[model samples]
Target: MSASVKSPRDPSTSFDDDVWPDSTDVLIMGGGPVGLSCAIMLAQRGVDVLLVERRDFVFRFPRAHLLNPRTMEAFHDMGVAGDIYGATPAHDRWRKAAWYTTATGPGRFDGMKIGDVPAWGGGPDAERYRSSSPRAFANMPQLRLDPLIHRHALAAAPGRIRSRQEVVAIEQDSESAVVSVRDVVTGELRTVRARYVIAADGGRDSADLLGIELEGPRDMREVVNYHVSMDLSAWSEPDALLGHFLHPAGGARRRGTIQALGPTHYNRDSEEWLVSVAAWMVEGDPDDEAALFASIRRMLGLADDHEITMHSMTRWSYHGLVAKQFRDRRVFLVGDAAHKHPPTGGLGLNSGIQDAQNLCWKLAAVLDGQAPDGLLDSYQAERRPVVAWYTAHSLENANRHPPIAEALGFCDDEAAGFRGLEVFVSETPEGEAMRARVAAEVAHNAHDYSQLGVEAGYHYWAGALVPDGTPVPGDPSDPVTFHATSRPGHHLPHVWLDSATGGDGGSVSAHDLIAAAGLTLLTSESAAPRWRAAVAAASGNMPITVVAIADDDAAWTAVRQIDDDGALLVRPDRKVAWRAARLPADPDAELTAALETILRGGDAPAGDPAEPYLRRIRAAANVLVR
Candidate 1:
């Protein structure tokens, strides 16, 4: 059966002001996807959460559209993926992206497909993702997504997120953070205090409050996004995908690329559309209404009298930046507060949601007294390097676009621009060369479309991860191709097992067996009883669950690359913290020591071989005592 779809903000439901407590365990700023996610995860963990958003309602604009597998897996873990899938109601074919010369009259130029992978699976990485997660990539407009998350956040913890509430000032010391919030409609102010705060509030303004500076390029380019509703049915084809790329045309002064927001098939009678006009703004105003409209109309091959209704126009500056520090004293940054990048691969929202996933469980553990305060230091140590890689990858994806334009002789920087486009479509030797180069460029950009490795292959090397003596595996040369493995410090490999099924007989991802907040132990049935006993004995304060498979489950064991008698310890985030090739002489002691090491941010028992690695992490986190 499909998951039931319901809005938490049903008219019958009530979210009164009293639903939130005066004081909370965690205070999250911003009610964007990241903040809402943090609130939902924290509330689900039984943490009192309060979230404040300056906006009165969720933004109803098309923003991030690509929800990668990892983000879907995180939503699945939160038990919201099905609702999100249901909310989208778009087919796999609609999710595919194609480049077009013009939306008004296509087929004159052959289409260049970009998003080749199926949205709901049957793509090249389908089996791998099927093994790793129960969820797949989703291409839903952010306008639809934000409400689902907003409703979920409120449902999980009613009144936790108060909209139209602006955070005025934040004061923090060694123990807690005091936040001053103001009512947007009424000039009322109230102060709330929490032991820890999450700056999920997007933009660099929040960072400024903490005296943090963003490091890296502040602006890559400026774009004007036009939300238009018009009769575009005449321009669409049965094979057209959601994304349409307008080739450079209309001479240098009038030449600019336009992206059609599609394969959104609005009803023909009431056709509505959204598109962005992007140009290198070296001179003149980027937001000149008359100029912007002409550029859009020309790119679409529309006549001067074409009827187009404009709803709204927003000018935005793209940035490739990361906060100099993710953490400052008692406050920690997440989402756009920590990093910003071009949306070439649609990693912004995905990374932000995962940032909440990474920090939520750790915060819960520490708050519950299952871990020490020092464990907080791992947040930056583990997330910074990932953000750095994503920033560079986003930059690379953005940089590759210019080469395609240059190869097509559409170099806007040159005195003669897009004049070669005529020759590019001709039957001459130069045209053939341009065609080959364009095809090669399109193929070379496969990573920008199917970024499985960048989305799923990033393994946390520090923070609460306990590295075994085994050497860590290297990532693929291509940032987007993933290799699943279960080495310590990496995500546990995925495998299908009948024991993971239920009365319905639907197969489950090994990941589904793990809980949202606990240590999961996987071992053979013969050792299951012992491991369970060890877990029971060792988990005096921490949460741990042990599962022992039958000795005949060789296939699953092989996927894990562990002996039937061996064991693997998985953290709450579905990452392998420690693994034993075989049961140690003292199972309880070994398991107990591993738990302690992880809770203490990779500390090891005296004489343990991993002590050196732990020391290095300590130095990087800056939490080591003199």
Candidate 2:
């Protein structure tokens, strides 16, 4: 697990089709980052999983970017964190999210400088961000991210991934789901049966085949992505990764975005970039390369002599949609198949990664006969609402764009816009006022890039979790705040603890204890023996383990929120399944009952998980006090 890395196998590498297996424990469709992640983590958990992707390899275009810290923690659990970290530019290279009037200046009075803000793991909140988790964020695009995830999936189970094979139809009965797959090149069909199916086909092809109906808007907005190789070092900021180029004549409604697609080395010096613009109603042809080039030159202030090489211009839709439900008997929807979002907050891919993480363990438990079939119901209960909040938050982030443009005087009124633009960077009192206004607005955009609470401290209720009757902790409504607690149905607060009470013990995050991929019973040293005895007597050979924190370990002692004899039962996904304030009269029976409740399916607290978060989403998105 050191920094040393082994070359991962390209997902395009062929698996033996001559001996296609007709059965698997889990069949994952779509080999994008989410599907590949599912395959890797499920295989790591000893599940018989097979992955099928229509494309021979992952698309090279930079699609989803900015793997948030929460996703990185999940990636760490999947054992691909090291590779993910190794594959990207340094966190500092692309840590600044800067805004500008245009790619070039209109005046010498800070003309191009609208304002600046730190992104990812930078700025005033950096320490607070690091305090919650052991892992940091990554800025690699999906084009580079997919193969790293795929490599681990292949390494975990060779011959498990089949490319160029597409799922045609799925029929589920009482036992397993029968899937009809077609080999794209040969036009031959293959039949496979699986206890569970993960539809990661981005919802386009697989949702209908499985008789699933999607709710929410479709084709909400059009975003054109231009992949081009250009030298932009002249106006590029040293520490910025995303450059917001608002047109000098363009209003608050329209602005151009430039994202660095660093192939290698530093992102500030990346040779390739993804330039995009959004339009509710476009006038010209959607694929007008000439118009796009003219816009790019206008945004970047490219000279006629400067050569611009256009690689490809992709026109994609921005829809804020979520599936009605995640579970359809034995079939589950994940990734784009489950929901889609506007690419403002970078929550789409991260949400999908977590969806797979939440479901795989439950699947393993049921397949191993450790949990009842009812456990599967928790998938939608626990995951969908989080996606709902992400959808709302992403829209909120998208909406932040216009206000920033307005502050910079990018408007339709020609004279008013020019006057406001001139005063924005002027040295007079009016100029100072405009400068301050733009600065404050640009800083507010931090919620789009560095909103820690939504990504890491997402609150969950119901489904697989056994919620103790307690009020929700911290500011659940604040999208920018995260407070670590050990309450049941909540993510276990992370704290570094020593292996032994002696001062010489090795340090590790609380997450490392659950590395074995099962329910972990965390108890203090004084209570360890009793918890161990209880687990031994009532585990029923389930994949449960008990760990004791030393009495001398202050970190665990502070966050546990339980008595010396109490314990917390954590699911494989790292959420607290149950909490015992103190030793039960019959520890064995108490432990057994908790397991039965979780495995047999317990009713979550009554409420729509999206309601409270939606209220917070509607609230002003400001930097919360950590």
Note the Cα lDDT for every prediction shown.
Answer: 0.68, 0.77
Worst 10 residues of 1 by lDDT: 1-10
Which candidate ranks first by lDDT, i.e. highest?
2
lDDT of 2 by residue, 21-137 (tens): 778889999999999988887777678888888888756688888888778988988888888788777556577788776565444432266777787777776887777787887
- Give RMSD to native, each candidate: 7.2, 5.1
In candidate 2, the residue pairs with backbone N, CA or C atoms under 3 Å apart (3 or more residues apart, or in different chains) clash, namely: 203-337, 462-604
Q: Report the C-alpha displacement of residue 207, candidate 2, in angstroms.
A: 1.6
Per-residue CA lDDT of model 1 for 22-141, tens digit only, reads: 566788888888999998888888777788888876476777767877889889877789987775535544444455556565334423222123322334646755655556777666
Whose TM-score is greatest here? 2
